[model samples]
Target: MSVQTWTWILVGITFALYFGIAIWARAGSTKEFYVAGGGVSPLANGMATAADWMSAASFISMAGIISFAGYDGSVYLMGWTGGYVLLALLLAPYLRKFGKFTVPDFIGDRYYSNGARTVAVICALIVSFTYVAGQMRGVGIVFSQFLQVEIIWGVVIGMCIVLVFAFLGGMKGITYTQVAQYCVLIFAFMVPAFFISFQMTGDIIPQIGMGGTLEDGTYLLDKLDALHTQLGFKEYTTGSKSTWDVFAITLALMVGTAGLPHVIVRFFTVPKVKDARKSAGYALFLIAILYTTAPAISVFSRTNLIETVSETKYSEIPEWFKNWENTGLIAWTDKNGDGKIQYIAGSAIDGKKPVYTEARGSYGERLIANASAAKNELYVDRDIMVLANPEIAGLPNWVIALVAAGGLAAALSTAAGLLLVISTSISHDLIKKQIRPDISDKSELMWARGSIFVAILIAGYFGINPPGFVAATVALAFGLAAASFFPAIILGIFDKRMNKEGAISGMVVGILLMLFYMMKYKLDMFGGGTQDDWWFGTSPEGFGTVAMIVNVVISLVVSRLTSEPPVEVQEIVENIRIPSGAGEASAH
Candidate 1:
């Protein structure tokens, strides 16, 4: 079948499967809507959590980031993966034991103040909304690019799916839908990876191919290293980052991952504290399936991109080239008037080579080798490497269609999870706990569904006109999470003396600081026309690390100077630490 025909067919099938699951597993009560009736098996919950955690950023953009970020990008891999370790070891079991439907409940009760819970609700909303915006954007981008639809129309489609899943079936619906999504996304990601790996390295498994020998009997990585060195870029498999920056970025990612409201809320789905622990382990293992493959895909795609376009004439490039070029993702300026594309480290304009500097110029400028004519430049969009992988590797049209479904699956699953969190926070934490204590379960459930619909609309708007790439938006959200929520959540769980004052103050400080940093970097510095204006020479991506540290320190110091939680609050903390109460802990 043609790409369009296959895309429509695959999309129809995918929608049917998801809607079927939602129908089969529809939630009948608030409990089911919020936590799938708390009956999810450890394995099932783990799988759902994996799907919930791996959003469009993971499926669509992570490999692309690594493809360009080179060694410095290892921070993303380590930080994102290592976070599960922290979640399992330090957070999940206790949060599960607390038996709360929302992260705010833990903070509110532990700190003995409704204010603390309110603060948490605000933080959760911010994190979930910011995070969901990126997923929505991913959904729209995939549809617009692959399906040849308007971005608004793509977002509308995604929003409708999310609404049906969240408002109609709730967590139960989302859970099963997420499992299906995981399968489709992982298969779509791996099939092309396998083909490319085998084609390049004679290895079927992408992870092994990443380290295997190339056709010339030299290590693939070794060749990449030589190429990078030849092009005046950093080596492929080593760190070129300052030690402190690497440490901070990695630490921030780990904490940010653990503290992500969407990921944390998944623990509530398990039946017991031990089950939560086990589910976390399963989540990480499932995550590793994709995370490990992502780097390999990055490397392979990077190599393929360099080889395919380096010396080729722009006119002679494949049809895919023109398609992507139409998206403004790929561009060429024949600076030297040469017909051949030039892939090089520096610019050659009017017969003069001008050095381009952005620090991590790891992928050298494309220069046609030894061409006497004007330099033919090729600018490939980073997002293209993953979405177009199947096409680039000469895979079938169905494979490309599968990828479209996979991208949608990844975006939708994560979006559904985030919307659920946002809904619960509004309905359970904000409304039920604060505004109307007498609200019935049915009323609260209705509110939750209503909140989901509103959240979908808000997120869909951003998705249709996304301010930036998926990774850029997600990274900024991570910074926001780190600044606003991570410190409060961590201190609330660990420090006995932490009180409402400390928690609330910390959240405000962290969020404001993070916003300031983000605005400077995204709006004024790197994003705006003003170049050479980074604070502390830190990229916006790395600034979150510093922001997180400040948040932690401020929270700790402020807590020490303030009054401690009440004796009742201390008992609440102790209760959370124990594993026995989860099974019978009454729902709020």
Candidate 2:
């Protein structure tokens, strides 16, 4: 069957399964809507958590980033992996024991201030929206390529689909849907890796196949390194980022992962503190399956990409290349009028992306609207590597279609989780806890569903116009979370003296500083400086670590100068730290 036919078949079947789960597990009350009734089995919650943790960023963009950035891209892998560990070990058990429906709920009760809760709600909204934009963008990328639709329309379609399950079942529906999604996405990701691995090096395991020699008896990494040298790029295995920058980026990603609200809320679904710990353990092993395989896929795809297209004539390029070019993610210009692609170092066009002309080039290729003078004649978006890998490897049509389904599963699962956070923050944190403490369960549930609908609309717009690459956008969201929430949560739990004043002040300052730096560097808002203007040589992605430190310092100083937290709040903190059981987790 054709790839498109198979894509429809697989996507239809998987989406049907998701919709079925949503129907079977629809929430009947606010409790079910918020934390799956806080009674989910540890294993099921773990699978759901694993699915929620691995978003489109992990499934689609992480390997793509690693493939292009080479050794420098290890920051994403290291930072995210370490960040998950940080969340699981350092935060999950305590928060679960605290028995809050959401992170902001925990903050409100722990800090003994509705104002503090409001600030945390704002932070969660910002981070969740920013993160969901990337997932929406990933959905658009998959649909635009395989479903043969414009990116904007793809995002719209995705928004409708997410709204169905989210509005119907809320957290209950999302959790079980994610469990099924985990199965689909993991299968989708691993199958392609196995196929390409065996095809390339006669090894079934991509991890081993990456290190295995080619049919010509050449080491794969060695050949890729030689390709780098030939193309005037740095060695594939060598680091390009400065030492401090690498550290900064890695640390930022780690803390950012820990601070992410959607991931944090996963622990609350389990029945007990011990169950939360067990859930974390199960999630770690489940998550490791893909995390370990990503780099191998990166190596295989990068090597395949170069060998297939480098110096190849535009007219003779394969169907996959043209299909992608039509989507405007890949572009080739006859810079030297040689009618062949020159994939090499440096930007290929005026900026990073190519502007399109309404006309085709001499070789029937898309014409660049603002072509650059650089010698490099190819422009390939890093986000496309994973999606295009199977096609690039000439794999079977069913495998190619499965990847599309898997990419959607990864994207939609996380998107549902994020939208739920946004919904719960408004409905539970903002409305029920603050404005209308006496509101009925039915009204709150209505408010939650209404909020999800609005959130999906906003997320769809951002998907149509994302700030940067999918992974890059997600990293900025992490920075926002780290700068805002990580300090408050850590200090509130570990420091008996962390009053509301300190927590609120630290959160306000940290997030604003992060926004300023991100806009100045990433969005080019504040004078739009270059890499040379980075504070202490840290990139925007790594600036979160700096902002987090500043938050910590400010939090400590403010807390020491201010009056201590109320005796009751301190008692609440001490109670959360007690690992005995859920006996006193209900203390206020």
**lDDT for every model?**
0.78, 0.91
Question: Model 1 over residues 330-442: C-alpha lDDT tens digits?
Answer: 55555555666667654333222222223321122333232234233555556667887777667788988888888888989999999999999999999999999999999
lDDT of 2 by residue, 194-244 (tens): 999999999999999989999999999999999999999999999989999
Off by over 4 Å in 2: 582-588
TM-score top scorer: 2
lDDT of 2: 0.91
